[model samples]
Target: MGSEKKSRLPAIVATAVAVPVAVVAGVLVFNAIAPKAEPVHEDLSPVAVEVPALSEEDAVVCLALTATAPESAGGLQARPVEGGAGAAESVMAYGDPAVVATCGVEPVAVEDTALVYKLNGVCWYSDEAGLEWTSLDRQVPVGVSVPETHEQPVDVLNDLSTAIADKVPAAAEAPTGCA
Candidate 1:
């Protein structure tokens, strides 16, 4: 009886060790055979981003972007606020092409912004509907022409943003004519 009990103990030990080793080997084999997942990159298109509701007389894009890039608590006064602090302060200040993406608003399309090449650090004058020379610090060529009504919405915005980003570098190359 003692020898039989000892033999059973070894069997139990062997079973326990073999089960764990089999499980581990099976996991390794499965991992080797499974297809790897490709890294996912989010499509950062502005229109792709869900747009917040828009009410007339409200600068939704600017306000949204301001929220994302908030300044220090009291620095709120220093950081530009959209529609409230004014367009020039809000839009002209952002020189990055990523502004539209950050704001989650499609860039506005207008007739006059087409012909005129807007310089970097200048606003498109859209928040105020072109009524007041509301220029904001935005990315775009200093004199890059803003898009007209006929141009595609996404294309125009993308172009304008790209222009804004390009304008700064171009301006740097051109000698200062004013001063």
Candidate 2:
């Protein structure tokens, strides 16, 4: 019984050592035989970003832009003229004869004292309007589609630059983090 127990101890010891070694060898063999994962590649190609042209109807000028006037004879104030037609309430008037005369422009009289004038692509009238050259203008209507206002003329150009930036598509792709 003693010899049998001693032989069993050797067998158990051998099994413990061999089992760990076999496991390690099996792991090495598996790593060498198993297929490796493929590397991922990104397909980055240039794409054309097309943005359509914006029209006046697509954008609207703020009421402040159409009404505010810098210092001048014809355009001396930021005053809004409310309620004449549809969406006409945003218009403001700036009238200064002294500034107008200095700008080197003539006035076309609408009334005896009030003259209809065109300046800076805007139409307006000054009661005591005098001939002057200014960066601002008082432009009256040559025909239909014109309204008379007593303030300095202002024409707000509706630009869609901001809208274009938000609406335009990305024509190119940028790299992400170290994927």
Candidate 3:
């Protein structure tokens, strides 16, 4: 009986050691066969923008307006503007070939016969080619230029009008073509 117990001990010890070794080997083999996870890279290089001189009131208004700008627009993340704090405060950009927004831009002049869109209480005037849209009813006009690659530039205006409505006040008079 003692010999039988001694023989069983070796089998028990071998099982304890082999079980752990097998588990370790299985884990290593699975890791080797599994698909590797690759890190995702996002382009965040600074975008170039030229800042125009603004009136004191326009400057203040633009700073406030830009402060309320969203972190993403038109499915693109916001990129850094090149011209330091002044440009950052007055302008914002998104994606490559960036969609740029400049506060305190020249106000849009909409002819009575021209088309105008009123979105979220903000009036917008689009250029002929639909590349640029300007806020017509804000104290400080905000211009957004969308690249031609974007099929629906008007949607970009619709998205930004919310921020403009929140931060910028209505002009003294409503736009001529916008009801």
Candidate 4:
């Protein structure tokens, strides 16, 4: 009886250890095979937008333009804009401090020294301060304010460029150095 009990003790210990090891290995294998979750922005609250005064025609154009704004920019999801009826003029936003868009803005006045970049057929007047970018070729200028935290402003612009091109008309006088 003593010998039988000692033999059973080793079997019990081995079974306990093997079961736990098997479970841990199975979990690791499952994790490796499963699709990874996409990164998500923490804040989804309405972003505050300071809407500018726009002409009746510009306002109408802006409303239509904003309606076509992209659902996502730079892999971030769109959030609602805060403020009053003026906020309706704004395009969607993504992330905290937000990558925001406002349409029907006054044409950007660029000096010869100003930095202008043509991206996806849209001419952008970029102000390094606050990372603001305004469309220089659109009839009713569109503005985008991207937070410094955003790693890829160009990617964000790329996402919105198609929408801007489809909805906003080109200005008669485009900024110099643009395609």
Best-matching candidate per lDDT: 3
Report the lDDT tens digits of candidate 3 across residue range 97-127. 7899999888766677778888877888888
Where does model 4 exceed 4 Å of error?
1-41
The candidate, 3 or 4, that scores higher on lDDT is 3
lDDT of each: 0.35, 0.30, 0.84, 0.82
Q: Cα RMSD for candidate 3? A: 7.8
Cα lDDT tens digits, model 2, 1-179, are 98999989988999999999999999999999999999853222221222222234321322222223232222233222333232221222233211111111232334333334333333334333322212112121111111243232333111111211222222232112101
Return the lDDT, model 2, position 32.
100
Comparing 1 with 2 on TM-score, the higher-scoring candidate is 1
Off by over 4 Å in 2: 44-179
In candidate 1 the C-alpha lDDT for residue 27 amounts to: 100
What lDDT is obtained when candidate 3 is compared to the true structure?
Answer: 0.84
Q: Which pairs of residues collide in candidate 4?
A: none
Q: Which rank order by lDDT, best down to worst?
A: 3, 4, 1, 2
Clashes of each: 27, 25, 0, 0
Q: In model 1, how large is the Cα lDDT of residue 123?
A: 42
Q: Tell me the TM-score of each prediction against the true structure.
A: 0.31, 0.26, 0.73, 0.75
